[model samples]
Target chain A: MTDTADLEALRREVRSFLAAEAPTGWRDASRTQDDFVRTQRDWFGKLVRAGYAIPHWPAEYPGGGRSLAEQKVIYEELAGADCPRLLLSFVSTYHAFATLHECGNAEQKARYLPKILEGETWCQGFSEPGAGSDLAAIKTRAELKGDVYVINGQKVWSTMAQFADKCLLLARTSSDGVKQAGITYLLMDMKAPGVTVRPIHQIQGDEEFAEIFLDNVEIPVSERVGEEGKGWAVAQATLASERGLTLMELSYRMRGALGRVAKLIREHGHEEDRGVLRDFGTLVTQVDAVCAIADQFLDNRINGIERMGDASIVKNAYSRALRAYSALGLRLGGMDEQYVAPITFGDLNTGNWMADFMNSYAWTIAGGSEEVQRNIIAERMLDMPREPKGWVL
Target chain B: MGAVIELNELTDAAQKAFPADKLSPSRDESWQLAAEMGWLMVRLPEEDGGLGFTREASTALHLEMGRVLAAMPLIPAQLGLQAVIASEDFAERADWLERLAGGEYAPLPMLSAKLTQGSDGSISGTISGVFEADMAVAVVAQLPGGYALVPLDAPGVSLVERPIWDPSRRLFDVVLESYTPTLMLTDASGAKALHDRLSGEAQLALAADCIGAAGAALDMTIEYMKVRRQFDRPIALFQALKHRAADMKTRIVVAEALLWKRVRDESASVTELAAAKVLAAEAFRFVTEEMVQLHGGIGLTDEHPCHLFLKRALLNLQLCGNADLWNERVGREALA
Candidate 1:
């Protein structure tokens, strides 16, 4: 209650700032991945200079130390303004910041944290080809030869690795214990020798994510976060870094993008078609409900009353609504959406219904996939019985 | 924030009053208890000699009542009271409000009516979806003569019981044959405005009820899954069933969030509130259907409560403008 006035003031400030400075026609400008990255950096830099970026950072750092409610207001404003999401620097500002700030030593923090603000982007190198939803099953091996750990293995699905200057590398340092226990977390310079970054051509024809090959790439032991073989615990911090904020933002964006569906309905002259209207209406409410749940999820977190499966519920709800949103667009677009159109980078619901539909799958399949979130919801939240773990496939 | 504490207190009181184990406890006795607890006056203005509470308070009560499959017609009763309270032009508004608040039954029909007003201003035809009309002193039927409080004891006013699939509550058709209008709650000019106001409130209440019932249905299904075994293990151990249950939870939680958000939003249009209802009703329908299927053949039996929830959900969908009506309106509104 005490922060109500402060939050209003912050909201007002953000709104006025966004009204004047929020980029227009960024989607059109961001047709190519390079243009998208440039747009993202410009927006991120503007936010940083305006003291709106990295609100979750420490008080000593610029644009840091915002409360969860304040951070929520910022995200809400950004989404409401239709500003480009900070996809290129998401890992650097959140995942990397959370990891170093929580688990890194003072020197690491002083060295890397400042650089993130200086446009040094980082990508997660944790998900290997063998890992993904089963993240602990990573096969990337790291050997400590002397002062540096020689990392050798492949990491797939690393978002924006091609543009990243550093990587949150998770590699197996031991094999004698549980799969999760053998892992170690390190910060590796992307320009380091024996490191290769190749963009992955997605089904939607966007190279937002890339595959990283580490052929004995060396990361100084000083760059290692936490103790060796304890990276899984640190990785949890990284994975949990963004919390429910991204989904909340995305939900708002989706809600705002409902206009696209409305536009399609009119374009196709289905305004009088009760069936199409009903479907559009259903999707509208679905998106609205997702926004509500996302807001509730963050409110619960801010109130310190969030349950174990709350985030999973928010994630699953958001992904399903995203699927429904894009599906409705694709359905309403009909024949026109079937044709290939140039897709916008780093934006969902870009009015290109087919590409947007394919992009929706990324949400369902990535970030601990829909199936995994469902398991968490069922087993943890609902208290349903877990399947016997020892059964082999 | 204060409302949350009130909600918790209300929830605790509701659990104590109507335990989940006693499903659909004697409707007459439960109605009496609800009246005694001042639920009828929960939404009444404090200046009107009733507890001044926000819509959230009433929403909380409806939700809790819904969880137990309450047989009491609290929703209609509250809506009826709200209608009287909002009718400033009515002559006996205060007296009618007092009686309604003190548990005299005068419920606004949940569904629409088809009445023809003759040249002499007399009304005929029927108002359907009147819940628990057997105990009502009157029914709030919207006549072209204006929104009037038609007393059941008046001439040509009769109640015909219309049995429904949902046994948790009873329904009736308030039949009118040359029924003369009296106790005008609102004039012809005010009728449309009051109807819109109460319709929005009705949608919120039903949405809350649907969400509550869906939650209860999902809880029941999950509990049964944990205990019921097949193939030498609890059926909940299977991934397929667990995923379905999880999806049910997700739908309920999301819909509930929308319900609460809409309840607090005073600027929300009737279409928006109805949209909330559509979402909640659909979620409830989904959960109850899953409940019946997940419980297997036992769910089909009359003795099982799964069918009760499913029936209530189906009926709730119609009580609202139905998903089809509300959804189209919502789409139309969004387009504008």
Candidate 2:
């Protein structure tokens, strides 16, 4: 109850700020991912200048470097305002900047950190055809041919690869060694010759992902982040980010969705449907529990101890509740505008329901499928026997 | 406060204390070993020299049992012990209780049987999914008026033993015709009360099982997403999948919370109990089905153990009622 009150005040402040700064037509205007990215980067660029976006960025790296609690307040406000994301934050804040601060050599930091801080984006190119879930099976070959390593192989589902200015590339440098042992981590130029980019069409009809085909994409060996054949270790270092990322703001997201549902109920003239009422009750309770867990886990993660399983729990639950809530939105609205996106349902006020339901799949699969998370919980936490047929032979 | 005891720690200790090889399949030895540990009759009242824990503790015990996926009828026997604790005549059977608790005697709760009509006082027919029937010394049945404690060796009764998804809790197709019964209460309320309490408790137990199964399924899906790439990035980081995986986590957590809360607060209504059963059932169906789809090609086969989870969920899903049916009930209640 106390936290709810604090949350209310935070939400109000965010609502006013967003009302002033957010462009009016952005809500109904459907933009391509590229356009969306530019708008978001502009927003992030302002938030950074205004000292709101990088609240947790270690203060030195384009981040306000605020305390964890202060950072949580920012997320709470952001969600309260239903803020659009920069998506580039993943590259700038989590991956590249984190690498620069943690493991980067001095020159590497001097070269890349400022660019990232200034909003230059990088994409992770860890996954190869042979190395999807079995990331160690990557067959993307790079030879140390003099000062430059000749690169060859293809990368698919490279998030934002087409738009990225730089790429965090993983390649095998040795023909004879353990598959995971022969790898190298490099920050490579995206516009280098022999590099090609093709967008991958998702079932959701979003060209947000790309396939980067490499043929002799050359990078000097100096671009390597760590010692050769130790890319696997550097990649592992980046993974702690999985736990570091927070959904703390979902408490506010839940509130916003509830507000939309509440408005839909009043205006839709279907307030009498017992099914819809039950759906409302279920969603409310679900969001309540989800927000509670997220809050607890946020507090835990902020305290410098992480509950990885709980992180998985948060990612899985809220994503689902939101999807289910959207289904109820469609149900309550009588199926008239389910396919309509880029247009906010004015009377019903269910903005972006269709986009969200289509987009929610990323929650489970992105965080590691619920199954992979269970293996971690079972093996690492509960101490159950190793999952039969795990990553290892 | 409600009398539900949370003994996950105790049961975890029990599992470690009574590990599996000691209770391996085909050894009545596991039951004997469990009896020595007083686990067989942990739900029986202390007046009968049993542990006297309420039915809620059975959930904690079953959760631990599920961790190993052990092959035994431990949960049902404990349910039978609770039945004994609730009845005066049944409680007086100290030899049965001590033996039941001590593992010398095995009691079975034969609650689910296809209903049949009878002209007279006695009704007889075949009922299925009566687990451990072959191993049970005495089978207990909750009738319309009271419970019947029938010795397995009694005349006019036949049990066709069969395997179910959880082979540890084997199934039985039992046939009985106008069989004379023992230990009948003249009043019916006791029987209904026992039925309600145990069914609620049983559904909760089954829900806990689904949580275990769903937890496993989610873990598998996560692992597959992390390494299994479609284009270049781990398919997991993709938005479409990341959300579904997150959703599965939410469902399981809700089921876990409600089940635990019900156990912690045993005063929940039958409708509340039914709602939980319905939600837990649906959670499994949804989460497990998604698990298979997320795993892609390898998940669709018998080799994946994903199907095993589906099968378990399907059986339990049907038992307490299907989702649409229960959802309708919840709607009615919310309207009221």
lDDT tens digits by residue: candidate 2, A1-393: 125476566556656767777544544443566566666677777777666766656656555566666567767666656666446566666777666667789998888876765788888888776666667888888898889999999887777787889998889998676777898888889999998989877655666678888999999988998899988888877666533335656555665667666667777864566666667656655665566567667666666666446665666566667677777766666665455656321111235656555555655555466556655544444333342343564
Q: Which DockQ value does candidate 2 get?
A: 0.07
Q: Can you give the TM-score per candidate against the true fold? A: 0.98, 0.56
Error of 1 at A366 (Å): 0.6
Candidate 2, B97-189: lDDT as tens digits? 665676644343434665454667665876655666777776767655577666777787787877666433567766778766665632466
Tell me the tens digit of each residue's lDDT in model 1 across A1-393: 328899999999999999999999999999998898889999889989999989999889988988899999999999999998988989999999999999999999999999999899999998877788889898989999989999899999999999999999999999986788899999999999999999999999899899999998988899999999999999999988987899999999999999999988898899899899888888888889998999999999898899988898888888888889889889888898888898999988898988998999999998989999999999999998887765687
lDDT at A222, model 2:
88
Kindly give the stretch of ten consecutive residues in candidate 2 chain A with the minimal lDDT sum. Answer: A342-351
User: Which stretches of model 1 miss by more than 4 angstroms?
Assistant: none
* DockQ for all candidate structures vs. native: 0.81, 0.07
Best by DockQ: 1
Residue B10 of model 1, lDDT score: 84
